[model samples]
Target: MLWRSPRREDAYEIHELVRQCPPLDLNSVYNYLLLGEHFSDSCLVAERAGSIEGYVSAYIPPLTPEVLFIWQVAVRESARGAGLGGRLLQRLLARPAMGRIRYVETTVGPDNAPSRAMFLRLAGHLGAPVHESLLFDRSLFGPDAHDDERLMRLGPF
Candidate 1:
Protein backbone atom coordinates (compact mmCIF):
# COMPACT_ATOMS: atom_id res chain seq x y z
CA MET A 1 0.00 0.00 0.00
CA LEU A 2 1.18 3.54 -0.77
CA TRP A 3 0.94 5.70 2.34
CA ARG A 4 0.70 9.47 2.10
CA SER A 5 -0.99 12.56 3.47
CA PRO A 6 -4.61 12.92 2.44
CA ARG A 7 -5.74 15.36 -0.20
CA ARG A 8 -9.14 17.07 -0.27
CA GLU A 9 -10.02 14.88 -3.23
CA ASP A 10 -9.59 11.81 -1.02
CA ALA A 11 -12.26 12.87 1.46
CA TYR A 12 -15.15 11.03 -0.18
CA GLU A 13 -13.21 7.81 -0.37
CA ILE A 14 -12.07 8.22 3.22
CA HIS A 15 -15.65 8.84 4.29
CA GLU A 16 -16.78 5.67 2.53
CA LEU A 17 -13.99 3.73 4.14
CA VAL A 18 -14.99 4.94 7.62
CA ARG A 19 -18.62 4.10 6.85
CA GLN A 20 -17.59 0.56 6.03
CA CYS A 21 -15.62 0.20 9.23
CA PRO A 22 -18.28 -0.11 11.88
CA PRO A 23 -18.01 0.74 15.58
CA LEU A 24 -16.23 3.77 14.15
CA ASP A 25 -18.20 7.00 14.21
CA LEU A 26 -18.41 8.43 10.71
CA ASN A 27 -17.99 12.16 10.47
CA SER A 28 -19.37 14.33 7.67
CA VAL A 29 -17.47 14.43 4.38
CA TYR A 30 -16.97 18.15 4.89
CA ASN A 31 -15.22 17.47 8.17
CA TYR A 32 -12.98 15.00 6.38
CA LEU A 33 -12.16 17.56 3.70
CA LEU A 34 -11.10 19.94 6.42
CA LEU A 35 -8.89 17.30 7.97
CA GLY A 36 -7.08 16.89 4.66
CA GLU A 37 -6.81 20.58 3.96
CA HIS A 38 -6.01 21.78 7.45
CA PHE A 39 -4.47 18.85 9.29
CA SER A 40 -2.74 17.04 6.44
CA ASP A 41 0.44 16.94 8.49
CA SER A 42 -1.11 14.58 11.02
CA CYS A 43 -3.69 12.69 8.95
CA LEU A 44 -2.80 9.90 6.53
CA VAL A 45 -4.16 7.74 3.76
CA ALA A 46 -3.15 4.34 2.46
CA GLU A 47 -4.01 3.69 -1.16
CA ARG A 48 -3.35 0.85 -3.57
CA ALA A 49 -4.41 0.56 -7.18
CA GLY A 50 -6.07 3.97 -6.82
CA SER A 51 -8.40 2.72 -4.07
CA ILE A 52 -8.28 3.92 -0.50
CA GLU A 53 -7.41 1.00 1.76
CA GLY A 54 -6.87 2.70 5.09
CA TYR A 55 -6.99 6.12 6.77
CA VAL A 56 -6.15 7.71 10.09
CA SER A 57 -7.33 11.12 11.27
CA ALA A 58 -5.18 12.79 13.89
CA TYR A 59 -4.12 16.24 15.00
CA ILE A 60 -1.77 17.82 17.48
CA PRO A 61 -3.84 19.66 20.04
CA PRO A 62 -3.10 23.37 20.12
CA LEU A 63 -2.67 23.40 23.89
CA THR A 64 -0.64 20.22 23.87
CA PRO A 65 1.59 20.20 20.84
CA GLU A 66 3.44 17.16 22.14
CA VAL A 67 0.34 15.02 22.01
CA LEU A 68 -1.06 13.51 18.81
CA PHE A 69 -4.77 13.04 19.30
CA ILE A 70 -5.96 10.29 17.01
CA TRP A 71 -9.60 10.69 16.10
CA GLN A 72 -10.26 7.70 13.89
CA VAL A 73 -8.64 4.73 12.24
CA ALA A 74 -10.33 2.92 9.36
CA VAL A 75 -9.32 0.00 7.19
CA ARG A 76 -11.35 -1.48 4.38
CA GLU A 77 -12.92 -4.85 5.22
CA SER A 78 -10.69 -6.54 2.67
CA ALA A 79 -7.68 -4.88 4.22
CA ARG A 80 -8.35 -5.99 7.79
CA GLY A 81 -5.67 -8.01 9.58
CA ALA A 82 -2.02 -8.06 8.54
CA GLY A 83 -1.44 -5.03 10.81
CA LEU A 84 -2.60 -2.29 8.41
CA GLY A 85 -4.16 -0.23 11.20
CA GLY A 86 -1.01 -0.25 13.30
CA ARG A 87 1.15 0.44 10.27
CA LEU A 88 -0.96 3.48 9.42
CA LEU A 89 -0.34 4.82 12.93
CA GLN A 90 3.38 4.15 12.76
CA ARG A 91 3.67 5.93 9.45
CA LEU A 92 1.68 8.86 10.79
CA LEU A 93 4.03 9.30 13.75
CA ALA A 94 7.06 8.98 11.50
CA ARG A 95 6.18 12.17 9.65
CA PRO A 96 8.71 14.97 10.13
CA ALA A 97 6.04 17.31 11.47
CA MET A 98 5.37 14.79 14.23
CA GLY A 99 8.97 14.74 15.41
CA ARG A 100 8.05 16.58 18.60
CA ILE A 101 5.15 14.33 19.43
CA ARG A 102 5.96 12.53 22.62
CA TYR A 103 2.54 11.14 23.36
CA VAL A 104 -0.42 9.59 21.55
CA GLU A 105 -3.98 9.88 22.80
CA THR A 106 -7.29 8.45 21.63
CA THR A 107 -10.66 7.53 23.01
CA VAL A 108 -11.93 4.01 22.56
CA GLY A 109 -15.20 2.38 23.45
CA PRO A 110 -15.02 -0.14 26.27
CA ASP A 111 -15.48 -3.21 24.09
CA ASN A 112 -13.45 -2.23 21.07
CA ALA A 113 -10.80 -4.90 21.33
CA PRO A 114 -9.21 -4.29 17.96
CA SER A 115 -8.57 -0.61 18.62
CA ARG A 116 -7.33 -1.30 22.13
CA ALA A 117 -4.99 -3.97 20.86
CA MET A 118 -3.63 -1.69 18.18
CA PHE A 119 -2.80 0.99 20.71
CA LEU A 120 -1.28 -1.50 23.08
CA ARG A 121 0.93 -2.82 20.33
CA LEU A 122 1.97 0.70 19.50
CA ALA A 123 2.89 1.44 23.09
CA GLY A 124 4.93 -1.75 23.22
CA HIS A 125 6.81 -0.76 20.09
CA LEU A 126 7.47 2.69 21.44
CA GLY A 127 8.44 1.38 24.89
CA ALA A 128 5.89 3.67 26.44
CA PRO A 129 3.37 3.10 29.19
CA VAL A 130 -0.38 2.95 28.57
CA HIS A 131 -2.77 4.80 30.80
CA GLU A 132 -6.56 4.60 30.71
CA SER A 133 -9.12 6.90 32.26
CA LEU A 134 -12.69 8.00 31.80
CA LEU A 135 -12.95 10.55 29.02
CA PHE A 136 -16.58 10.55 27.95
CA ASP A 137 -19.58 9.01 29.58
CA ARG A 138 -22.16 7.19 27.51
CA SER A 139 -24.85 9.67 28.57
CA LEU A 140 -22.76 12.47 27.13
CA PHE A 141 -23.69 11.17 23.69
CA GLY A 142 -27.28 12.25 24.25
CA PRO A 143 -29.83 9.83 22.75
CA ASP A 144 -27.48 8.30 20.21
CA ALA A 145 -26.92 5.05 22.16
CA HIS A 146 -23.18 5.43 22.07
CA ASP A 147 -20.93 3.58 24.44
CA ASP A 148 -18.68 5.19 27.00
CA GLU A 149 -15.42 6.34 25.47
CA ARG A 150 -12.41 6.10 27.72
CA LEU A 151 -9.14 7.84 27.12
CA MET A 152 -6.13 5.72 26.23
CA ARG A 153 -2.80 7.46 26.36
CA LEU A 154 0.69 6.29 25.51
CA GLY A 155 3.39 8.72 26.39
CA PRO A 156 6.94 9.98 26.62
CA PHE A 157 8.08 8.02 23.62
Candidate 2:
Protein backbone atom coordinates (compact mmCIF):
# COMPACT_ATOMS: atom_id res chain seq x y z
CA MET A 1 0.00 0.00 0.00
CA LEU A 2 1.14 3.57 -0.67
CA TRP A 3 0.10 6.78 1.05
CA ARG A 4 -0.28 9.99 -0.93
CA SER A 5 -2.32 13.18 -1.02
CA PRO A 6 -5.81 12.89 -2.56
CA ARG A 7 -6.63 14.46 -5.89
CA ARG A 8 -10.00 15.79 -7.05
CA GLU A 9 -10.31 12.81 -9.35
CA ASP A 10 -10.25 10.33 -6.50
CA ALA A 11 -13.54 11.56 -5.10
CA TYR A 12 -15.73 8.80 -6.51
CA GLU A 13 -13.60 5.97 -5.21
CA ILE A 14 -13.36 7.66 -1.83
CA HIS A 15 -17.11 8.09 -1.81
CA GLU A 16 -17.69 4.40 -2.42
CA LEU A 17 -15.33 3.39 0.34
CA VAL A 18 -17.20 5.49 2.87
CA ARG A 19 -20.57 4.36 1.56
CA GLN A 20 -19.71 0.75 2.25
CA CYS A 21 -19.24 1.42 5.90
CA PRO A 22 -21.91 1.65 8.57
CA PRO A 23 -23.44 5.09 9.25
CA LEU A 24 -22.67 5.93 5.64
CA ASP A 25 -22.59 9.53 4.49
CA LEU A 26 -21.21 10.95 1.26
CA ASN A 27 -21.81 14.65 1.75
CA SER A 28 -18.59 14.82 3.70
CA VAL A 29 -16.56 14.05 0.59
CA TYR A 30 -17.59 17.29 -1.05
CA ASN A 31 -16.86 19.17 2.12
CA TYR A 32 -13.52 17.40 2.34
CA LEU A 33 -12.52 18.62 -1.08
CA LEU A 34 -13.58 22.14 -0.22
CA LEU A 35 -11.64 21.99 3.02
CA GLY A 36 -8.78 20.37 1.15
CA GLU A 37 -8.36 23.55 -0.82
CA HIS A 38 -7.57 25.41 2.36
CA PHE A 39 -5.30 22.71 3.79
CA SER A 40 -3.99 21.69 0.38
CA ASP A 41 -1.49 19.05 1.30
CA SER A 42 -3.16 17.51 4.30
CA CYS A 43 -5.87 15.30 2.80
CA LEU A 44 -4.48 11.86 2.01
CA VAL A 45 -5.12 8.75 -0.05
CA ALA A 46 -4.01 5.16 0.33
CA GLU A 47 -3.58 3.20 -2.84
CA ARG A 48 -2.52 -0.27 -3.83
CA ALA A 49 -1.79 -1.44 -7.38
CA GLY A 50 -2.68 2.04 -8.61
CA SER A 51 -6.23 1.94 -7.21
CA ILE A 52 -7.53 4.01 -4.33
CA GLU A 53 -8.03 1.82 -1.26
CA GLY A 54 -8.57 4.26 1.56
CA TYR A 55 -8.50 7.94 2.50
CA VAL A 56 -8.18 10.19 5.53
CA SER A 57 -8.88 13.91 5.86
CA ALA A 58 -7.33 15.69 8.81
CA TYR A 59 -7.04 19.33 9.73
CA ILE A 60 -5.94 21.66 12.49
CA PRO A 61 -8.86 23.99 13.09
CA PRO A 62 -7.97 27.61 13.89
CA LEU A 63 -10.31 27.49 16.88
CA THR A 64 -8.40 24.52 18.24
CA PRO A 65 -4.89 25.61 17.35
CA GLU A 66 -3.03 22.78 18.97
CA VAL A 67 -5.29 19.91 18.01
CA LEU A 68 -5.46 18.00 14.76
CA PHE A 69 -8.92 16.64 14.21
CA ILE A 70 -9.18 13.57 12.01
CA TRP A 71 -12.36 14.53 10.29
CA GLN A 72 -12.80 11.32 8.33
CA VAL A 73 -11.15 8.00 7.65
CA ALA A 74 -12.42 5.11 5.55
CA VAL A 75 -10.99 2.06 3.86
CA ARG A 76 -12.57 -0.02 1.14
CA GLU A 77 -14.00 -3.14 2.77
CA SER A 78 -11.63 -5.21 0.66
CA ALA A 79 -8.73 -3.24 2.06
CA ARG A 80 -9.71 -3.43 5.71
CA GLY A 81 -7.35 -5.09 8.24
CA ALA A 82 -4.30 -4.49 6.10
CA GLY A 83 -3.10 -1.50 8.10
CA LEU A 84 -4.06 1.09 5.49
CA GLY A 85 -5.98 3.12 8.06
CA GLY A 86 -3.08 3.16 10.43
CA ARG A 87 -0.68 3.97 7.61
CA LEU A 88 -2.79 6.90 6.49
CA LEU A 89 -2.95 8.15 10.06
CA GLN A 90 0.79 7.76 10.57
CA ARG A 91 1.46 9.75 7.40
CA LEU A 92 -0.85 12.51 8.53
CA LEU A 93 0.83 12.68 11.90
CA ALA A 94 4.26 13.04 10.32
CA ARG A 95 3.45 16.02 8.11
CA PRO A 96 5.40 19.15 8.98
CA ALA A 97 2.18 21.15 8.80
CA MET A 98 0.98 19.08 11.72
CA GLY A 99 4.03 19.78 13.85
CA ARG A 100 2.24 22.28 16.02
CA ILE A 101 -0.59 19.82 16.55
CA ARG A 102 0.09 18.12 19.83
CA TYR A 103 -3.14 16.11 19.79
CA VAL A 104 -5.10 14.31 17.12
CA GLU A 105 -8.74 13.54 17.93
CA THR A 106 -11.57 11.54 16.43
CA THR A 107 -14.95 10.28 17.60
CA VAL A 108 -16.01 6.66 17.21
CA GLY A 109 -19.67 5.93 17.57
CA PRO A 110 -21.01 3.72 20.31
CA ASP A 111 -20.92 -0.02 19.38
CA ASN A 112 -18.33 0.43 16.65
CA ALA A 113 -15.85 -2.02 18.08
CA PRO A 114 -13.58 -2.17 15.08
CA SER A 115 -13.15 1.58 15.05
CA ARG A 116 -12.87 1.74 18.81
CA ALA A 117 -10.18 -0.93 18.74
CA MET A 118 -8.28 0.88 16.02
CA PHE A 119 -8.36 4.09 18.03
CA LEU A 120 -7.19 2.27 21.13
CA ARG A 121 -4.27 0.76 19.26
CA LEU A 122 -3.33 4.10 17.78
CA ALA A 123 -3.58 5.79 21.15
CA GLY A 124 -1.37 3.14 22.68
CA HIS A 125 1.23 3.68 20.00
CA LEU A 126 1.09 7.45 20.51
CA GLY A 127 0.96 7.20 24.31
CA ALA A 128 -2.32 9.07 24.46
CA PRO A 129 -5.34 8.56 26.66
CA VAL A 130 -8.67 7.21 25.48
CA HIS A 131 -11.60 9.16 26.82
CA GLU A 132 -15.13 7.81 26.83
CA SER A 133 -18.42 9.63 26.91
CA LEU A 134 -22.11 8.85 26.77
CA LEU A 135 -24.26 10.23 23.95
CA PHE A 136 -27.88 10.67 24.93
CA ASP A 137 -30.86 11.19 22.69
CA ARG A 138 -34.62 11.43 23.05
CA SER A 139 -37.05 9.18 21.26
CA LEU A 140 -39.82 10.59 19.11
CA PHE A 141 -42.50 8.78 21.11
CA GLY A 142 -40.96 8.93 24.55
CA PRO A 143 -40.50 11.60 27.17
CA ASP A 144 -37.37 10.20 28.76
CA ALA A 145 -33.99 10.44 27.09
CA HIS A 146 -31.99 7.39 26.04
CA ASP A 147 -29.50 5.90 28.41
CA ASP A 148 -25.70 5.72 28.22
CA GLU A 149 -24.05 5.12 24.89
CA ARG A 150 -20.31 4.81 24.45
CA LEU A 151 -18.31 7.24 22.36
CA MET A 152 -14.54 7.08 22.42
CA ARG A 153 -12.01 9.88 22.06
CA LEU A 154 -8.42 8.74 21.65
CA GLY A 155 -5.90 11.47 21.23
CA PRO A 156 -2.85 13.65 21.69
CA PHE A 157 -1.53 11.84 18.62
Candidate 3:
Protein backbone atom coordinates (compact mmCIF):
# COMPACT_ATOMS: atom_id res chain seq x y z
CA MET A 1 0.00 0.00 0.00
CA LEU A 2 1.17 3.52 -0.74
CA TRP A 3 0.86 5.60 2.39
CA ARG A 4 0.52 9.32 1.76
CA SER A 5 -1.22 12.51 2.81
CA PRO A 6 -4.88 12.76 1.86
CA ARG A 7 -6.12 14.96 -0.95
CA ARG A 8 -9.32 17.03 -0.96
CA GLU A 9 -10.71 14.82 -3.70
CA ASP A 10 -10.42 11.81 -1.43
CA ALA A 11 -12.97 13.15 1.06
CA TYR A 12 -16.03 11.45 -0.42
CA GLU A 13 -14.25 8.13 -0.69
CA ILE A 14 -12.90 8.43 2.80
CA HIS A 15 -16.37 9.18 4.09
CA GLU A 16 -17.64 6.07 2.33
CA LEU A 17 -14.83 4.00 3.80
CA VAL A 18 -15.79 5.13 7.29
CA ARG A 19 -19.42 4.44 6.56
CA GLN A 20 -18.62 0.84 5.63
CA CYS A 21 -16.45 0.39 8.70
CA PRO A 22 -19.26 0.03 11.16
CA PRO A 23 -19.16 1.18 14.78
CA LEU A 24 -16.99 4.12 13.67
CA ASP A 25 -18.95 7.34 13.63
CA LEU A 26 -19.25 8.68 10.11
CA ASN A 27 -18.64 12.40 9.71
CA SER A 28 -19.73 14.71 6.92
CA VAL A 29 -17.67 14.70 3.76
CA TYR A 30 -17.23 18.41 4.36
CA ASN A 31 -15.45 17.64 7.59
CA TYR A 32 -13.11 15.28 5.78
CA LEU A 33 -12.60 17.86 3.03
CA LEU A 34 -11.48 20.34 5.62
CA LEU A 35 -9.07 17.85 7.09
CA GLY A 36 -7.70 17.02 3.70
CA GLU A 37 -7.32 20.63 2.61
CA HIS A 38 -6.13 22.17 5.86
CA PHE A 39 -4.91 19.39 8.14
CA SER A 40 -3.44 17.18 5.47
CA ASP A 41 -0.14 17.43 7.27
CA SER A 42 -1.59 15.39 10.12
CA CYS A 43 -3.89 13.10 8.17
CA LEU A 44 -2.93 10.11 6.05
CA VAL A 45 -4.31 7.76 3.43
CA ALA A 46 -3.16 4.41 2.06
CA GLU A 47 -3.85 3.39 -1.49
CA ARG A 48 -3.03 0.32 -3.56
CA ALA A 49 -3.79 -0.33 -7.19
CA GLY A 50 -5.44 3.08 -7.34
CA SER A 51 -7.86 2.16 -4.58
CA ILE A 52 -8.05 3.79 -1.18
CA GLU A 53 -7.50 1.02 1.36
CA GLY A 54 -7.11 2.88 4.62
CA TYR A 55 -7.27 6.35 6.14
CA VAL A 56 -6.44 8.02 9.41
CA SER A 57 -7.76 11.43 10.41
CA ALA A 58 -5.75 13.25 13.02
CA TYR A 59 -4.69 16.73 14.05
CA ILE A 60 -2.45 18.52 16.48
CA PRO A 61 -4.60 20.50 18.83
CA PRO A 62 -3.97 24.26 18.61
CA LEU A 63 -3.25 24.53 22.32
CA THR A 64 -1.29 21.29 22.48
CA PRO A 65 0.94 20.87 19.51
CA GLU A 66 2.71 17.95 21.08
CA VAL A 67 -0.46 15.93 21.18
CA LEU A 68 -1.81 14.14 18.11
CA PHE A 69 -5.48 13.55 18.55
CA ILE A 70 -6.56 10.83 16.13
CA TRP A 71 -10.14 11.36 15.08
CA GLN A 72 -10.69 8.17 13.09
CA VAL A 73 -8.99 5.14 11.55
CA ALA A 74 -10.63 3.24 8.70
CA VAL A 75 -9.30 0.28 6.78
CA ARG A 76 -11.34 -1.42 4.10
CA GLU A 77 -12.50 -4.96 4.91
CA SER A 78 -10.35 -6.37 2.15
CA ALA A 79 -7.34 -4.78 3.90
CA ARG A 80 -8.17 -5.82 7.41
CA GLY A 81 -5.65 -7.65 9.61
CA ALA A 82 -2.01 -7.83 8.38
CA GLY A 83 -1.32 -4.88 10.71
CA LEU A 84 -2.46 -2.16 8.31
CA GLY A 85 -3.97 -0.17 11.15
CA GLY A 86 -0.80 -0.12 13.17
CA ARG A 87 1.28 0.55 10.11
CA LEU A 88 -0.91 3.50 9.23
CA LEU A 89 -0.34 4.97 12.68
CA GLN A 90 3.39 4.39 12.58
CA ARG A 91 3.56 6.02 9.19
CA LEU A 92 1.66 9.01 10.51
CA LEU A 93 4.04 9.50 13.40
CA ALA A 94 7.03 9.08 11.13
CA ARG A 95 6.09 12.17 9.15
CA PRO A 96 8.38 15.20 9.54
CA ALA A 97 5.46 17.38 10.57
CA MET A 98 4.79 15.04 13.49
CA GLY A 99 8.35 15.12 14.76
CA ARG A 100 7.37 16.99 17.93
CA ILE A 101 4.41 14.87 18.77
CA ARG A 102 4.89 13.13 22.12
CA TYR A 103 1.41 12.01 22.93
CA VAL A 104 -1.16 10.14 20.85
CA GLU A 105 -4.74 10.40 21.95
CA THR A 106 -7.92 8.68 20.70
CA THR A 107 -11.26 7.63 22.03
CA VAL A 108 -12.48 4.05 21.88
CA GLY A 109 -15.71 2.45 22.88
CA PRO A 110 -15.70 -0.22 25.59
CA ASP A 111 -16.74 -3.08 23.34
CA ASN A 112 -14.52 -2.12 20.45
CA ALA A 113 -11.87 -4.70 21.06
CA PRO A 114 -10.24 -4.39 17.67
CA SER A 115 -9.65 -0.66 18.03
CA ARG A 116 -8.58 -1.02 21.66
CA ALA A 117 -6.11 -3.74 20.75
CA MET A 118 -4.69 -1.81 17.83
CA PHE A 119 -4.02 1.19 20.07
CA LEU A 120 -2.48 -0.93 22.80
CA ARG A 121 -0.15 -2.51 20.26
CA LEU A 122 0.82 0.95 19.04
CA ALA A 123 1.67 2.06 22.57
CA GLY A 124 3.76 -1.05 23.08
CA HIS A 125 5.61 -0.45 19.84
CA LEU A 126 6.29 3.14 20.90
CA GLY A 127 7.60 1.93 24.26
CA ALA A 128 4.95 4.02 25.95
CA PRO A 129 2.39 3.35 28.64
CA VAL A 130 -1.34 3.44 28.00
CA HIS A 131 -3.59 5.67 30.07
CA GLU A 132 -7.35 5.60 29.68
CA SER A 133 -10.24 7.56 31.13
CA LEU A 134 -13.81 8.26 30.28
CA LEU A 135 -13.95 11.01 27.69
CA PHE A 136 -17.59 10.85 26.69
CA ASP A 137 -20.34 9.06 28.49
CA ARG A 138 -23.06 7.42 26.44
CA SER A 139 -25.51 9.78 28.06
CA LEU A 140 -23.74 12.72 26.46
CA PHE A 141 -24.95 11.54 23.06
CA GLY A 142 -28.45 12.52 24.19
CA PRO A 143 -31.14 10.39 22.59
CA ASP A 144 -28.88 8.91 19.97
CA ALA A 145 -27.71 5.54 21.19
CA HIS A 146 -23.97 5.61 21.47
CA ASP A 147 -21.36 3.84 23.44
CA ASP A 148 -19.35 5.50 26.14
CA GLU A 149 -16.18 6.83 24.61
CA ARG A 150 -13.04 6.42 26.67
CA LEU A 151 -9.87 8.33 26.11
CA MET A 152 -6.68 6.41 25.38
CA ARG A 153 -3.41 8.25 25.82
CA LEU A 154 -0.09 6.78 24.80
CA GLY A 155 2.83 8.99 25.37
CA PRO A 156 5.95 10.96 25.73
CA PHE A 157 7.77 8.63 23.37
Candidate 4:
Protein backbone atom coordinates (compact mmCIF):
# COMPACT_ATOMS: atom_id res chain seq x y z
CA MET A 1 0.00 0.00 0.00
CA LEU A 2 1.16 3.55 -0.75
CA TRP A 3 1.26 5.48 2.51
CA ARG A 4 1.10 9.26 1.99
CA SER A 5 -0.48 12.48 3.16
CA PRO A 6 -4.20 12.70 2.58
CA ARG A 7 -5.60 14.80 -0.26
CA ARG A 8 -8.85 16.71 -0.46
CA GLU A 9 -10.23 14.21 -2.96
CA ASP A 10 -9.83 11.49 -0.38
CA ALA A 11 -12.32 13.01 2.02
CA TYR A 12 -15.35 10.95 1.01
CA GLU A 13 -13.48 7.68 0.74
CA ILE A 14 -11.82 8.24 4.08
CA HIS A 15 -15.22 8.98 5.59
CA GLU A 16 -16.43 5.63 4.25
CA LEU A 17 -13.48 3.86 5.80
CA VAL A 18 -14.27 5.45 9.18
CA ARG A 19 -17.91 4.32 8.93
CA GLN A 20 -16.83 0.75 8.24
CA CYS A 21 -15.07 0.70 11.58
CA PRO A 22 -18.09 0.69 13.84
CA PRO A 23 -18.02 2.71 17.10
CA LEU A 24 -15.51 5.15 15.59
CA ASP A 25 -16.83 8.68 15.95
CA LEU A 26 -18.17 9.06 12.42
CA ASN A 27 -18.02 12.66 11.26
CA SER A 28 -19.46 14.51 8.31
CA VAL A 29 -17.76 14.49 4.93
CA TYR A 30 -17.35 18.24 5.23
CA ASN A 31 -15.35 17.80 8.39
CA TYR A 32 -13.21 15.19 6.67
CA LEU A 33 -12.65 17.55 3.77
CA LEU A 34 -11.48 20.19 6.20
CA LEU A 35 -9.12 17.77 7.84
CA GLY A 36 -7.68 16.67 4.54
CA GLU A 37 -7.23 20.18 3.29
CA HIS A 38 -6.22 22.01 6.43
CA PHE A 39 -4.30 19.31 8.25
CA SER A 40 -2.86 17.32 5.39
CA ASP A 41 0.57 17.66 6.90
CA SER A 42 -0.52 15.76 10.00
CA CYS A 43 -2.91 13.37 8.28
CA LEU A 44 -2.14 10.27 6.19
CA VAL A 45 -3.84 7.94 3.77
CA ALA A 46 -2.81 4.56 2.37
CA GLU A 47 -3.73 3.68 -1.16
CA ARG A 48 -3.70 0.25 -2.72
CA ALA A 49 -4.12 0.14 -6.49
CA GLY A 50 -5.43 3.71 -6.39
CA SER A 51 -8.10 3.10 -3.76
CA ILE A 52 -7.89 4.43 -0.25
CA GLU A 53 -7.21 1.50 2.07
CA GLY A 54 -6.41 3.28 5.31
CA TYR A 55 -6.42 6.74 6.85
CA VAL A 56 -5.14 8.60 9.89
CA SER A 57 -6.61 12.02 10.65
CA ALA A 58 -4.66 14.20 13.04
CA TYR A 59 -3.82 17.81 13.83
CA ILE A 60 -1.74 19.99 16.14
CA PRO A 61 -3.98 22.06 18.36
CA PRO A 62 -3.23 25.79 17.91
CA LEU A 63 -2.05 26.42 21.46
CA THR A 64 -0.35 23.05 21.73
CA PRO A 65 2.14 22.97 18.91
CA GLU A 66 4.12 20.29 20.67
CA VAL A 67 1.18 17.92 20.71
CA LEU A 68 -0.13 16.07 17.70
CA PHE A 69 -3.65 15.04 18.62
CA ILE A 70 -4.64 12.12 16.46
CA TRP A 71 -8.30 12.44 15.66
CA GLN A 72 -8.97 9.07 14.05
CA VAL A 73 -7.35 6.06 12.43
CA ALA A 74 -9.18 3.66 10.13
CA VAL A 75 -7.83 0.82 8.07
CA ARG A 76 -9.97 -0.98 5.57
CA GLU A 77 -10.75 -4.56 6.60
CA SER A 78 -8.71 -5.86 3.68
CA ALA A 79 -5.67 -3.93 4.93
CA ARG A 80 -5.86 -4.82 8.61
CA GLY A 81 -3.17 -6.86 10.37
CA ALA A 82 -0.58 -5.57 7.94
CA GLY A 83 0.59 -2.71 10.20
CA LEU A 84 -0.51 -0.02 7.77
CA GLY A 85 -1.77 2.07 10.66
CA GLY A 86 1.68 2.27 12.21
CA ARG A 87 3.28 3.09 8.89
CA LEU A 88 0.78 5.84 8.26
CA LEU A 89 1.41 7.29 11.70
CA GLN A 90 5.18 7.20 11.37
CA ARG A 91 5.04 8.90 8.02
CA LEU A 92 2.76 11.61 9.29
CA LEU A 93 5.01 12.44 12.22
CA ALA A 94 8.14 12.29 10.10
CA ARG A 95 6.79 14.96 7.82
CA PRO A 96 8.54 18.34 7.90
CA ALA A 97 5.48 19.99 9.44
CA MET A 98 5.85 17.79 12.51
CA GLY A 99 9.52 18.52 13.09
CA ARG A 100 8.68 20.31 16.34
CA ILE A 101 6.20 17.80 17.65
CA ARG A 102 7.01 16.55 21.11
CA TYR A 103 3.89 14.66 22.11
CA VAL A 104 1.25 12.44 20.56
CA GLU A 105 -2.22 12.17 22.02
CA THR A 106 -5.12 10.00 21.02
CA THR A 107 -8.24 8.55 22.58
CA VAL A 108 -9.05 4.88 22.26
CA GLY A 109 -12.13 3.01 23.31
CA PRO A 110 -11.48 0.44 26.05
CA ASP A 111 -12.51 -2.40 23.78
CA ASN A 112 -10.30 -1.28 20.90
CA ALA A 113 -7.31 -3.48 21.56
CA PRO A 114 -5.92 -3.10 18.07
CA SER A 115 -5.68 0.67 18.32
CA ARG A 116 -4.10 0.52 21.76
CA ALA A 117 -1.56 -1.99 20.54
CA MET A 118 -0.75 0.10 17.50
CA PHE A 119 -0.11 3.19 19.63
CA LEU A 120 2.04 1.17 22.03
CA ARG A 121 4.10 -0.08 19.13
CA LEU A 122 4.49 3.47 17.87
CA ALA A 123 5.70 4.62 21.28
CA GLY A 124 8.27 1.83 21.35
CA HIS A 125 9.46 2.65 17.86
CA LEU A 126 9.98 6.26 18.84
CA GLY A 127 11.59 5.31 22.15
CA ALA A 128 9.08 7.45 23.95
CA PRO A 129 7.16 7.00 27.17
CA VAL A 130 3.50 6.02 27.18
CA HIS A 131 0.78 7.20 29.55
CA GLU A 132 -2.91 6.37 29.66
CA SER A 133 -5.85 8.12 31.34
CA LEU A 134 -9.59 8.49 31.02
CA LEU A 135 -10.20 11.31 28.50
CA PHE A 136 -13.80 11.04 27.41
CA ASP A 137 -16.57 9.59 29.49
CA ARG A 138 -19.79 7.96 28.31
CA SER A 139 -21.61 11.04 29.46
CA LEU A 140 -19.92 12.95 26.62
CA PHE A 141 -21.83 10.72 24.25
CA GLY A 142 -25.12 11.45 26.00
CA PRO A 143 -26.98 8.64 27.82
CA ASP A 144 -24.36 5.89 27.78
CA ALA A 145 -24.42 5.67 24.02
CA HIS A 146 -20.78 4.72 23.71
CA ASP A 147 -17.90 3.45 25.77
CA ASP A 148 -15.57 5.92 27.47
CA GLU A 149 -12.46 6.85 25.55
CA ARG A 150 -9.12 6.63 27.29
CA LEU A 151 -6.30 8.95 26.44
CA MET A 152 -3.06 7.41 25.16
CA ARG A 153 -0.03 9.69 25.26
CA LEU A 154 3.36 8.96 23.75
CA GLY A 155 5.91 11.68 24.04
CA PRO A 156 8.87 13.95 24.21
CA PHE A 157 9.93 12.94 20.77
**Superposing all C-alpha atoms, what RMSD in Å does each candidate have to the true structure?**
0.7, 3.9, 0.7, 1.2
- Pairs that collide in candidate 1 are none
**lDDT by residue (tens digit), candidate 1, 57-154:** 99999999999999999989888888999999999999999999999999998999989999999999999999999999999889989999899999
After superposition of all CA atoms, the RMSD between model 4 and the true structure is 1.2
Cα lDDT of model 4 overall? 0.89
Candidate 1 vs candidate 4: the lDDT winner is 1
lDDT of 3 by residue, 35-113 (tens): 9999998899999998999999999999999999999999899889889999999999999999899999999989998
lDDT of 3 at 11: 91
Model 2 poorest ten-residue lDDT run: 140-149
Give the alpha-carbon lDDT of every model: 0.94, 0.72, 0.93, 0.89
Q: Per-residue lDDT for 86 in model 3?
A: 92
Residue pairs in steric clash, candidate 4? none
Each model's total of backbone clashes:
0, 0, 0, 0
TM-score of each: 0.98, 0.81, 0.98, 0.95
TM-score of 3: 0.98
How do the residues 1-157 of candidate 4 rate in per-residue lDDT, one tens digit apiece? 6877777788888888899987687999999999878887888888989999888889999999999999998988878898988998998898989999999999998888899899999999999999999998878878647898899999887
Candidate 1 to native Cα RMSD, angstroms: 0.7
